[model samples]
Target: MESEQALESEAEQGERLGWWHHSHPTFAGITGFFAGMLFVTALPGAFAGLLRLLLDYETAEKLFPFVLLALALPIAMLVKRKTRRFAQFMFVGMVVTALVVLGVASLVLYFMVDA
Candidate 1:
């Protein structure tokens, strides 16, 4: 029911969904790191003693910023070189790291919750 101009405007707004849109290179890495951290950190006692109570939900929300920082710093250091390679490496590393973390966390959760 919308006019052509309205449809065009909506498409433009959709494209501007900011840094984490799939079209953005870092989106995968950014999401992966946090997802991995969440899995590993979800165990009730995992971070309590060592982190001394920094494992709360509010603190967990900071994971995204931390991952972004991790990805950005390394890329910035190599910005003058082959950026595509750097991006690929960082994104893949982030994804792999997340998968490993998630696997471990799931195992832990499975044991803890089931038993």
Candidate 2:
């Protein structure tokens, strides 16, 4: 009986530490939103690279954002741990900035290549 109680307590402790806990109320929302934004922003570059390597546009498009999301999720989690509530705003800002920079760079690169 004691061992069972101990095990249950340990499980609760683990739950408290997880991102979904009340203490980290914003963690999931922020992480998910940022991860999505990051994935979408990087999708074009990832797709292009994958397409170049595999010459399979369909596969590349499908896998590109999954890979990007995998990469972005950890980063967002790290930020959430470090900065808590501010992490959400920071993540959103960072994603927007990245998208803007990527968009501008791609346009420039396209023009340069065309010229």
For this target, which candidate reaches the highest lDDT against the unseen true structure?
2
Question: How well does each candidate superpose onto the true structure, as a TM-score?
Answer: 0.35, 0.41
Error at 52, model 1, angstroms: 10
Query: Could you give candidate 2's per-residue lDDT for residues 8-90 as a string of tens digits?
Result: 99999888777364566666567656655655567566667867698677776666555545555546655656544444654
**Backbone steric clashes in candidate 2, count:** 0
- Tens digits of per-residue lDDT, candidate 1, 1-115, equal 5798899888888877754554677665565455444433453234344344557666665543443444455456346554444444555555676678789999999999999
For model 2, what is the C-alpha lDDT against the true structure?
0.66
User: Global lDDT for candidate 1?
Assistant: 0.57
Clash counts for the predictions, in order: 0, 0
Segments of candidate 1 deviating more than 4 angstroms: 1-67, 74-81
lDDT of all predictions: 0.57, 0.66
Report the alpha-carbon TM-score of model 1 versus the true structure.
0.35
Off by over 4 Å in 2: 19-23, 56-99, 102-115
Best candidate (score: TM-score): 2
